[model samples]
Target: MGLRRLDIDRAALLTALTARDEGLLGTWLDLRDGTLRALVEPDDEAFEARLESESDHYVKVPLFTREFRLMAEFVEQVDDDELAVRLDQALAGPSAFRAWEGVLAADPSEQRHWRAHRESALEQWAASWLAGIGLTAPWTDEVPAPEVPALLALVMDGPVRRALGSDAEAHTTYVRACRDLCELLREPFPSRRVRSASRFARGPVVIERSGRDVTIRLRADDEAG
Candidate 1:
C-alpha cells in the first residue's frame, strides 16, 4: 500500500458547511471531527468496497470525502491483486452511468430524429429521482408533437442559438434540472437486476422487483418518437 498526505481545502469545506443540504453539513462536520480518517487510511480493497456500498445521492461534503478517500487509496496502490479483484467487481456491476448508457442504447430511433424526445425522457427521469430525495423541481414539458425535419432541427439545435427558441429554452431548463438532479445522484451503487428481455424499451422502465412492490426503474434508449 502507498500513502500520500491528504489535503483538505479549508475554503471549500466552509462553503459546504453553509450549504442548504443537511447531508452536506453532516459531512463537513464529520471531516472537521476526523470521522473521514477511516475511509482514507484503509487498504485499497477495503476502501473501494466501502465506497461500493455507499449510496450515490450524497451532498457535496460527502461527495468530496468519498472522492478524497478513493483517491488516497489509489495513491497507495496497496495489494495490486486485491485492487484488481475489486476493480473487476466494481466494473461488472450496473452503475448509474451504465443506466444512462442503456437509455441511449435502447433508443431505436435515429439520433438526429429523436434527440428532443430522448432529452425529455432523460430530464423527466432525473427529475423523478431528485424528487425522491426531497429536492422538488418542476417537470419538463418539451415533448413537442410530431414535427417535420426542419422544425425538429430548429428545436433540437436551439441550444446553439442564443435566441429564445423552444429548443433553446427546453435545453436550458433541462440542463439546470439535470444538474440539480446530478448533485443529488452523484454516487454509483448497484441497481436491482433488470429483466434482460425488457432492456430494450424506451424511457424509464422498471426492470426488477424486490421486496414489497419496489421496482427499480432503468433508463432505456428505445423511446417512442
Candidate 2:
C-alpha cells in the first residue's frame, strides 16, 4: 500500500483547529479504541471494530505504544506547555501528565500561567505545522486583501469568534468545530495495509518515518513492556 502523503487542506484545518477548544482536542487524540467506542456505544462490537480500524487506517506503520503515544501527545499537547514537559518526563519516569492535574487545580496562579503558556505555544505550534505542510502565509500579519485581508481573519474573527461568543448555541458550535478539527488531525494513515489490532500490544516499539520508509525498531523482550 502506498503511504498517504500529509495532504489535508491548509485553510480548512487551520479554521477547524482555531475554532475548537484546546482541551477537547487533547482528549480526542488521547482516546483509545475502548474509550472511543464508549464515546459512542460500548456494547456494539461492530462499532468497536470500526473505531479500531480507524486508528489503524491513519497510522499504517503499526506504531507501538511508544510511537502512538508520542503522536497522540503531539496533537493533544500542541498547546500545553506543562503537559509537554511532563510528557518528556513520562518517557523516562513513572510520573505522567495526569499527575499534574491535582496540583494545577489547587494552584490558580499556576493554572492561569499554564493556560497562557499553552496559547502562546499553540500560536507557534500551529505556524510550524502549517509551514511543515507548505503554508507559510496563514498566521502572518500581512494581508492579500481580495476576499479577506488576513489569512487568520476567517478563523480568528469567524468561527472561533462564534465559538467563544455568548449566544445560546455557541457551545454547540464550539463543540462541532472542535470535533471537526480532531477528525481532521486523526484522518487515517494513508497506507492501505492496515496492521492487525494485535500489533498495538508489541512494545517497546520504536518507530521512525521519513517519506514512505516506516520502520519499527523492536526492543528486547525485557524492555518491551
In the order shown, the candidates' Cα RMSDs to the true structure are 21.1, 19.9
Considering every candidate listed, which one attains the maximal TM-score? 2
Please state the error at residue 218 of candidate 2 in Å: 18
Per-model TM-score, in order, reads: 0.20, 0.28
Clashing pairs in 2: 4-190, 57-189, 58-188, 58-189, 204-224
Task: State the displacement of the C-alpha of residue 131, model 2, in Å, after optimal TM-score superposition.
Answer: 1.7
Range of the 10 consecutive residues with the lowest summed lDDT in candidate 1: 193-202
Clashing residue pairs in candidate 1 are 1-78, 2-76, 56-187, 103-220, 103-221, 106-221, 106-222, 107-221, 107-222, 202-222
Every candidate's lDDT? 0.33, 0.36
lDDT (Cα) of model 1:
0.33
Best candidate according to lDDT: 2
What is the lDDT, from 0 to 100, of the residue 180 in candidate 1? 28
- Total backbone collisions for each predicted model: 10, 5
Q: Could you tell me the lDDT of residue 83 within candidate 1?
A: 46
